[model samples]
Target: MKKKIILIAVFVIAVAASVYLYAMYKPHRDITAETADFTVSVKQLQEEYAKNDTMFNKKYMDKTIEVKGVVSTIDDAENGIVIDEKLSVTFNDSTKKEIAVGKSIKIKGRLLTYDDILEEFKMDQASVIK
Candidate 1:
């Protein structure tokens, strides 16, 4: 009886550990290394921004997305990076370190959806390519 109980406990613990590790290391779905889809000009992005809708949100909301654009400006004061023309993206310190003004690069991360009075739809949480 004692051996059976101990075996059961070990099995349960092993299953729990496996579940935790899977959750921790699981690769996010919907991530793509797509560059052709994101090759629009800065002016085009600005036009979309003016329309209060972005292709970013249209295509990759609630999923991992990858895009390539020029780094127009870096607002350290605001902890954000402005890409294309008018896309204001905020990211953490590690992401910021990989971006620089005038550099053409790729960003891959989860796309968050937001609806506000100023902007109808927006995407956030983008990571930078090193």
Candidate 2:
């Protein structure tokens, strides 16, 4: 009985460790390949978040979304862009050179956070759609 119990316990431990390792090593979601959950302009998303942040946060948080606006600023060091002075998006492709200031473009990314003090929305793993 003692040997049987010891064997079962060892089996359980091995299974648990395997499960944990698999989960930890699993690849992250590719946001660029995934479809956007919502599509809105920079103005609309910023206004909605400003009005009721908690409600919108529950709705938009951690979800992939697409936003359209003109590029207001480009940070080459960060490989990112601010749209309409309200949304900040960091692109996955550091070599992307299609964007320019004052040019209208569409981008898809996962909504990361809303900075109420700055009144801006931040996204990551972004890709240019237009």
lDDT of each: 0.61, 0.90
lDDT of 1 at 52: 57
**Can you give the TM-score per candidate against the true fold?**
0.47, 0.86
Backbone clashes in model 2: 0
For candidate 1, give the lDDT of residue 112: 60
lDDT of 1 by residue, 1-130 (tens): 9999999999999999999999999985533343323444445544664575666457545655455678878888877776764456666444666677998877665546544554422445556665
Off by over 4 Å in 2: none
Scored by lDDT, the top model is 2
Candidate 2 local lDDT, 15-104, one digit each (tens): 999999999999999998999999999878867887998899998989999899999999999999999998988989883578889999
Q: Which ranges in model 1 have alpha carbons more than 4 Å from their true place?
A: 1-58, 113-121
Worst 10-residue stretch by lDDT in candidate 1? Answer: 30-39
